[model samples]
Target: MLREETAKLLMMIQGAYPNYKPDNKTVTINTWNLALSDISFDLAEKAFLAYLRADTKGFAPAPGQLIALVHELNTPQQLNELEAWSLVEKAIRNSIYNSQEEFSKLPPLVQKAVGSPNVLRLWAADGSYSEQVASSNFMRSYRNEAKKQEEYEKLPADMQQMIDQTNRNSYSAQIREKNRDAIQIMTTTENAEIEVKDEPTGISQQSDERLKKLIEDFRKI
Candidate 1:
């Protein structure tokens, strides 16, 4: 899935604007990380290679080729250079480039993934760490949230069936609730069977109370 997503996105960008300087820093890795986690440099290499193939043979990209489909819609027959260039700009901004505002507006899972430094691992070594670091709190929350989501995904289909769990329906709304409850709202109809993380703890008992209070106050950060 990660490879396919990477392939489609690279294909879209390259197909649209062949002359654009490839900024692996300003492009490719981060948005790809958000849209498709588990995507490594190896997968990206494969995606770019496949993109070259698509360019050569005009072969249809695999089934879930969203950007390919979108580009096809934008320029069906031989695209005028200007139209192709325009689509390239849009695709670069929408896919290759990373915008904080755009990241903030992503679906919860995408937002969560984008919220983490680990997701932007490729760019870490590019001297942008001071300027583009993901906050520890944000990364922690993203991981916590992603884990609960993974748990929800692993539930048996028969145990928690869905008819229309679209962005407008149960799936999107539940992503906003704090982690454990969000998991329950998605899957555990019984509620009794759900697993929640242990409540936040402090160093000790009497001092622990004060520590907990201090921690909560700090979290208002």
Candidate 2:
């Protein structure tokens, strides 16, 4: 936010908390501006209002607190673990004939934890598969994915960009390594074929004659 917007927010805070008298007004504004510049003024104002309603301490909020509140405001509502598992259980029951269709109907996060339609089919077909075990595993995976998404959403735009770039780089490196290994395997196989073709003719003939004699002996027996 701009310095003027930050100053306005601080003014609101000062009015709310009579004892919140900063000795250096200019320094406080600059600090708040620097900390909150990435956030929009409207969002910052909303966060301030939320903080005021929720706070019982009667103390003025710092920039960090406002940033936290903004993240909370921005997060979308999500299903709890039990609700997510209930959907999966229903899908599993119906997956016997139309596994792919059932899989497609799952939420993105639950779909990730379930892996694929083939997995659902396997679980459905296996009488030995334990519903309790499956429920426990799915809930754990769902919780982890939810937490990861929440943390990612809370990151600043710049930080998110950096993380995305790093992931792209890592994926590119893995692809390159896999290609290199394939090339090495193909080269080694080609070299082996060349060596076999270049073997002494005398040795090759003897090996063929021995194979023919063994075939004749087997026929006679």
Candidate 3:
């Protein structure tokens, strides 16, 4: 992935600086070898692509500039009040913890996002809080969905159709997996019942109960 990204970046650089003829390759392969070792392909490619789009003056950034951009991307900033609160709401709804004590033991990121545990507890118990939290959450979701839909609309007709088909195939695969699991569970239950019936009349009630419990647990999974 890094090599592929490196190749794309080099191509972009050559396009931007056509006059800068090189004695060697577009980029020294050895230089990329060292850079790729430290940063991920996604970070490098995203930063480079962002630079290409934002730097309208068309001055090519040096290779070190790309690495610096990766650092800028990694540096975390304080979230605004709404973003922090939305994250807290998401954690409260989705986290496995069932009690305040358990919630307190959640990851530090979750703790910090909540801003204050007391406020979270109060909001969680308030009916009005749900509407507010949901509105904030929905706003973010709507913006993301709108952006994706806008991008899709910009694509060529054929490309849009291809993406739609891929999404359909993914959904179909998930349905098939669920069906397979259901069928397996039913077949296992029937087979177990048959085995129990075939057992000698001396089979204990405890053994029958154990088999039923196992089947119930497996089916839940």
Candidate 4:
């Protein structure tokens, strides 16, 4: 059922953009459909819809893009374990420290959770960590700890010390919420500029007044 749907989707994409024919000599349609066989029908359809709606001029969506879209949209539980393992693999590659140095840098809690040096080296160096070891719990803990450390480093020195002394988890959440509010307000103000007055002198004065008001409002924030 999904195979046939995939075939139809391929045809739809080609039909929508006549100039964008995939290199069938390198990859046949059957092979592409086979690659996407594991994806559910609903996910495939949604991905196709999203592809069609994209504001691209002339390009067919690749098979890999469709697979990625399914992963991004549905994110099934079993696939999450695989993605978590991939994150561990990425961290290993991205680490500046050698195996021993990186192993030592793990938080005590993470070290305890990850087990011995042999296992740590396998995870960080060889990408041999099992899905069981890289469970959702470990993924969440590692990501949260990394995010906290990153945010802490970005703070002013005094603010960092104050947060450390207070040891308040809510402080991070408060900062994130404030950032979100500011972004929303800015977006609203930008979208509110619906009218463009075009008289020469009138436009110049209006622009000056609007700029001044914007600067004043920003400073108040």
**Between prediction 1 and prediction 4, which has the larger TM-score?**
4
Compared with the true structure, what per-residue lDDT tens digits does model 1 show for residues 1-221?
36455555566656656564456733553555454453344544455455555666544333235333333333324323333233323322433223322334445554544432223332333445442133443455555665655445433344335532453366444434333332222222212222322422221243445445555644453
Q: What C-alpha lDDT, on a 0 to 100 scale, does residue 189 get in candidate 3? A: 44
* Selected candidate, larger TM-score, 1 vs 3: 3
Query: lDDT for each of the candidates?
Result: 0.41, 0.79, 0.56, 0.56
User: How do all models score by TM-score?
Assistant: 0.21, 0.64, 0.31, 0.34
Q: What is the descending TM-score order?
A: 2, 4, 3, 1
Residues 11-118, candidate 3, lDDT per residue (tens digit)?
767787676455676456556645555566778778787787788776777667776677567655434445644556654553322224434554444453343343
Model 1 quality (TM-score): 0.21
Give, for candidate 1, the lowest lDDT window spanning 10 residues. Answer: 183-192
Candidate with top TM-score is 2
lDDT of 4 by residue, 3-108 (tens): 5776777777778878877677335567766766666677777887887787476677777777666655664223233454454455455342243344456554
**Steric collisions counted per model:** 0, 1, 0, 0
Report the C-alpha lDDT of model 2 over 1-221, residue by residue, as the tens digit.
88899999999999999899999999999988988889999999999999999899888898888988898887768889999999999999976555667877999888867866667767887889999999999899999998887777767789999998897679555554454343334333434445677764655566555545645544453
Among these predictions, the greatest lDDT belongs to 2
Q: Is candidate 2 or candidate 3 better by lDDT?
A: 2
Off by over 4 Å in 3: 78-221
